[model samples]
Target: MTNQDSKVLRRNLLAGSAAVLAAPAIVGTALAQDKVTWKVQSHWPKASGSFNDSLVALAKELDTRTGGRFKLETFGAGEIAKDREIYNIVRRGVVPMGTISPAYILGEAQAMGLFYGVPGTLRETWEMLQLTKNLGIEKLVNDELAPKGVVMKAEKAYPTEVVLRRKIASAADLGSLKIRSAGTMLEYLAAAGASPQQIAGPEIYQAISTGVVDGAHWGAAIGALSMKFWEVARFHMKPALGITNDAWIMNKAALDKLPADLKLQFLSLLEERYFLRSVEYLQQEAIALNTGKAKMNVEVVRWPDDVLKKFAEASTGILKKEEAKGEISAKGTKALIKLMTDLGYV
Candidate 1:
């Protein structure tokens, strides 16, 4: 064929191919949306509790709200992946989403943990919410997750309270006790005159029951109920040192594929659920504290102003050290301090 004829034939073929592909695109877009199955795992057990329960509930809500367009298959604690490995698993897309402790992975994203709990930093759940949204803490968390190919859908703060086998009302009371603490709480407790050790969530019950440690600090409402903490310790302290923040994370690639409206709806569901559950969970925990249904009998104690002041001082020192070590970004630290000052906590 002549050169001009050859070019004309190629153009016609390309047009026909484009039309064929466009037919399916139009049909698929009209069929509601693409159905995607995503697997989610949590750091908590399958049992109905905070971390795991929240994961399952969120998954169910997502499936329901999306009319089953998106399916999330959830694995309970240690079912498919261990709690400690959830971050790597989600990052690699082994699971599309999972529940993770931002603080637990601080070594990966130093600023992420600081956004959650930093003893004396955010004393209450309300303060935590404000700090998270104020400094764009949620976005900071999302940005950190991006490098790992994960995006945080929701972050929930566990109603915090310190648990001790013995009564501890003063900094002096802490000197004799060995405690199991995690993240910044470890350092804060250590500086508060207690010997603090780092331990995992699943190990706390056995660790305390066996006297492997004197006392351990975990969640107040959720931990108290899930671990049967009352059976192991005599006292459930009021106004725990700090709440544990767990993030519901999704694989960034997976999140990117959802319809734009679906993505917005899904995230809105998470935000609404986070606020509602936190309030309800704290209230449920209060009821549990009053009923005293925990396996072992225990008394509830409250930290005095003097001891709290000591804790705050120690926490401040730890925060400064973390900043010096470059574990927490200067930006995050400054934003946190500003929030604390505005709230009159600093």
Candidate 2:
């Protein structure tokens, strides 16, 4: 791939997607000849490279596959709505669809965290995918979201890595340090005896630089590299927390209006590309680690087995509380425990 094309592939970690299409219909049935274009708002800047290109590619696929009867226009984060505002805009149909992290909507239902990234779980992308499927997470979250006028679909899954200015060699390394974090991971970090704070994305670089926070669990290598986290903190924690999952959040009513054949085509593309997107993030993450080390003098820390064991223990405590959150969370927790148990981590 060309350098520019490769850069596009290097920068996505928490990215996700879903699309919508509609045209005038005869008695509620979409007409195959009708042309329609819907707008998609990204959760990151155009500099996000592959995260942005992935959606553009999806849009192109939709256009080519449907012979131009369907099209989507893409916009970067904040062009259509602020990151936190994407769910509302997409649901209200102010924009047909937008990229979002389920992390932002834990209030909609705590079970949404199952999709976001439940700490103490396996870090591998495929293992997490299996957890999502086994728990019927898609059905659970969408069941809540659909009635609210939104439908969520994940296009890719990538790890949320951590960076710190200090050495992290064991469980003691986790003690009393303030870290910027969000979602359920906060609870896990707290359980590990670390202080987790909520800081705006734009402020994180400065927060670390000024000792406002010791570290942050943002995106993986490529994403943190994009944010220049290495300038302030060189240790990039390895064995990422886990691949965070969000979605191409779409207006449910608009998507429901899609023709059956066209709808099938959309789903076919989503299914076929699920694993591909995860692998892309994984490959790009590896490249990013090399780039950061060679060009930016970044360091990688592989959390030891004992520290990881303490984490698993702490994760179970938080998992029980997660189970108490609601019905779906309870079921999802059981699935997490069952899987983790089989893997000998719980």
Candidate 3:
């Protein structure tokens, strides 16, 4: 074969090999006479790549791992319960498994949001994993789910940053600006002089577009892309404030009902799948937002060191004040700060 023909054949061979490597378990499972299936649901729409993409891959992985005997039929946001309702729905065993932002239900367990997104918390995936492992928060957090007949199997961090339509060159720019924020972030934004308005994630885009809100402090790249916030917001800020933890939880009753072997297999697969998909999610989001902004002509702004320092100082003070006021318990606040400090994030 000519050199060009040889290269084409080699490329095709590699692609074929990769497909087999990625899917060996599926082919094996199709041949199995005995197997089980799982019904998994999520609280995010299929359009958001992070939530749906992870679910789809997880389903495929489970199918492969169990030689097709175990499979997940996944549903996107609102297909089962509305986003806000997914947590209770899953906890009540309305669904076998449901993916959700555990932090969203902090009222149910005050520690949830603090563990989910403590300002100046984990930035990178590895650092996040380390914190989860070392802080003993993972078990404590998961235990809280057990009582609801849900077992939090996996958690992954998504970088959350501040995005503004108006340029924020310094702390002064935040003065009196009404920023859409949630939970602890509300305090952080307020400390910066931006009046934090409590709005649902879905409402942020319209609020910003219609001038109902000045800006939103939410997910870094993926959330920005999924919400199409860039269309209305001209500026994307750098130096992310923190990360949010999204979890995949299995209904404990459903898991208890599973055959022991299958349960173990599922747990193992869930863990691996979460780690793999989380990495892919962050990378994909980073690419999409970074490239998408250039195409859309949105300016990505980096805060000056002095500006970032001011934010950190003010946010730290706000956290301390809240802890003292019992807004967040002292134990929760101390544990979180200790974890962040140990991880070198603070």
lDDT of 2 by residue, 1-346 (tens): 9998777666542132211222233434545666778898877666554455478878888899989888889887678775678888888889888877787788886578787867767767887777766557767787887779988877677788889888776667787579888887787677667888987565778899999999996677877777778888898887776667757788888887877777778778876566677778788888888999999888888876766676677777766777898887888877877887888865
Question: Which runs of model 3 end up more than 4 angstroms from their true locations?
Answer: 1-37, 304-310, 317-346
Please list all clashing residue pairs in model 1, or write none if there are none: 161-240, 231-296, 234-298, 234-299
Top TM-score prediction, candidate number: 1
RMSD of 3: 13.5
Rank candidates, TM-score, best first.
1, 2, 3
TM-score of each: 0.84, 0.82, 0.78
Badly placed stretches (over 4 Å) of model 2 are: 1-30, 168-176, 206-211, 304-310
The count of residue-pair clashes in candidate 3 stands at 5
Sort order, lDDT high to low: 2, 1, 3
Q: Once model 1 is optimally superposed onto the true structure by TM-score, how far is the C-alpha of residue 310 displaced, in angstroms?
A: 2.8
Error of 3 at 162 (Å): 2.4
Sliding window of 10 residues with minimal summed lDDT for model 2: 13-22
Q: What is the lDDT of residue 106 in candidate 3?
A: 62
Tens digits of per-residue lDDT for model 1, 57-156: 7778888988888777877777777655888888888887888777677676667666556776776777676667656767766676687787874457
The CA-based lDDT of model 2 is what?
0.76
